[model samples]
Target: MMKKKLWSLGIFIILLSIIVYWFYFSKPTSFPTNEQLVAEMNRVFPEATASIIQDTIPIDERHVLAPFISKGDDYGLSYWVWKNHKWKVASIDTKGKPMLWKLNKSDPSSFYFVWNIDPKDQISSIHFYLIRDRGYQITRGIQHYNPKVQMGKRVSLQEKSYGLMQLSGTWVTFMNAYNKVESAKQYPERNMFFGWIPYDQKDMGIFPENSVNGASYSNGEIGLEYLMIVDKGQIEIPR
Candidate 1:
């Protein structure tokens, strides 16, 4: 009976140790306050204001060491802390367009911008002001090319122009000036040309009503218009 009790005690002690270790070391830490986040941003850019809000997607799930989150609806900014380090801007989007930017260690405070654009919008570029951690200020210095729209309405056999590569899984398209539509009879080969686009989807191609097939349009003055459409389970129209 004494041996049995000793064995049970040993098991209990091991379980307790595990529990204690989990509570002391394995549990996640707390995040910084919203005010602190704003203060950090202000330290970099005095003219900047901050607002805080909860991450809609629970950013903590992605980061094991996420800082405290500041949710402010009054201002258009949010703040957070993680890994004992603090940053002012976690993410930002202007108007309807998304600003392509990210922070890396080498360019910690330096942000690179890409314009997340829609082909329908006429504005082809983005502009912003960035303030480095060292108080050096510079304007957004990138020019993003607009996605290609449908070329003219006509197509010819000798034309080499196909069209811009469409971004996979997205409604964004890249139109090329040289590409024009070609009929299956001219080449007797029907294959859609794929161009380089970020996040290229494997199932992208030309569509002809029910099937994803390369297509062309022939307008009188515009000549041949070559187009490639991506189709998987469903068809999508570029926005």
Candidate 2:
């Protein structure tokens, strides 16, 4: 009986050691390079060649966000993760745009994200050309995207909700090319985007018809539009 007990303990120790080694001591292969990544992406998209906007955005040592544009110019987002001791393509958002990444959820009461999205326009890019100020002022500016220079501001209406439903949630804002007060380096007046007035509900009506209005709009979570939301966690967007 004593010998048998010792043998059983030895087997258990061996299994535990293997697990520890596999998880920590044994690392997976190196991260894929741009060329290797493009090849990997070709598996799903036959005509895939290069990334869409930029190269892969690293979330951490184990996770990466890759956006690709097909030879035909169609765009897509692919999420890769290190799993089972190998790099695996966990999932892909074929029609995802970077708008969701720009969405802000800092203040829920003052801002609410609209749960309505035009699925047909999923991969569409946002261009703000018309600035609708709170005073019903409107201005159009020519925005030149130099690719090298990062400029512009993004606003959102929501407290960073952890649920995945926010992925499809899009707060309505005027699509403008450039902000009028670029010198100030602040977001255009409250009228530039449509979000809730934050306070004095009755004042919402005082705004002119030409200005953009904002506030979160939803008929509860029961509809085709409220399918996926954004997660606040890094490399972990709940859907």
Candidate 3:
């Protein structure tokens, strides 16, 4: 009996050691090279026909965002995540329109909006919004009214065509508070949406010339939420 107990203890120690190594030390310490990224993009999305890798932006130690240009002159975006000891493409978009990527779903601060808009569109800047429409409901003879909430952030595209914008502190605070409310859980449809409006140098809103119509693909490893395009009339203008 003593001998059997000693053998079991030894096996348990070995298994724990393997688990530790696999979870913490097994992943590659370095980011994938541009060549490796291009190959992976081609392998996952042959339709992209990716020809040039524009840049690799590291979101964290294990997550990366790469913007690329295809042979057909399409601006595209690909998200890479280090998983199972190898770099994997989490998602890809041929149009490279603005998308909300939640790196850590439970934490609002980890959310980011990333895009690679085509220069031909003449987009000088972008206005991003976090909005929740007002609501009125009667539940159990109680009158409930939810006020419309709207928040906006503008980013210039003059400096660079491809970039990322993290959720503002105000937006994060609102989201954190909303998530705690019981009503939010009950009415998921009433939750806020991420939207955007592109403006030209003349400060006029215009539909993007290229990205509006295109074919896109995703493997669904990561949830890349599409941002709705908002018309100027839809937003509240300050008096």
lDDT of each: 0.28, 0.38, 0.86
Candidate closest to the true structure, highest lDDT:
3
Q: What lDDT score is found at residue 11 in candidate 1?
A: 100
lDDT of 2 by residue, 1-239 (tens): 99999999999999999998887657666878867777766665444344543456555576556655545444455556676677766544443332232222332222212221122322111211112322222347644332221112233313311111222122222122233344255553333322222111222212222111211212222111111222212112135
TM-score of every candidate relative to the true structure: 0.24, 0.37, 0.90
| Candidate 2 structure lDDT | 0.38
Higher-ranked by lDDT: 1 or 2: 2
Index of the highest-TM-score prediction: 3
- Of candidate 3, the 10-residue stretch with the lowest lDDT total is 182-191
Error of 3 at 232 (Å): 1.2
Tens-place lDDT digits, model 1, residues 1-239: 99999999999999998877765446344444545555655555444333432222223322211111213212122222232132224432211122222223222122222222222222222212211111222339654332222221111212211111112222112211112332324552223232111121232222222111211111122111222222332222256
Q: Model 1: what TM-score?
A: 0.24
Model 3 misplaced stretches (Cα beyond 4 Å): 1-5, 8-12, 23-27, 138-141, 182-189
Q: Candidate 2 — number of clashing residue pairs?
A: 22
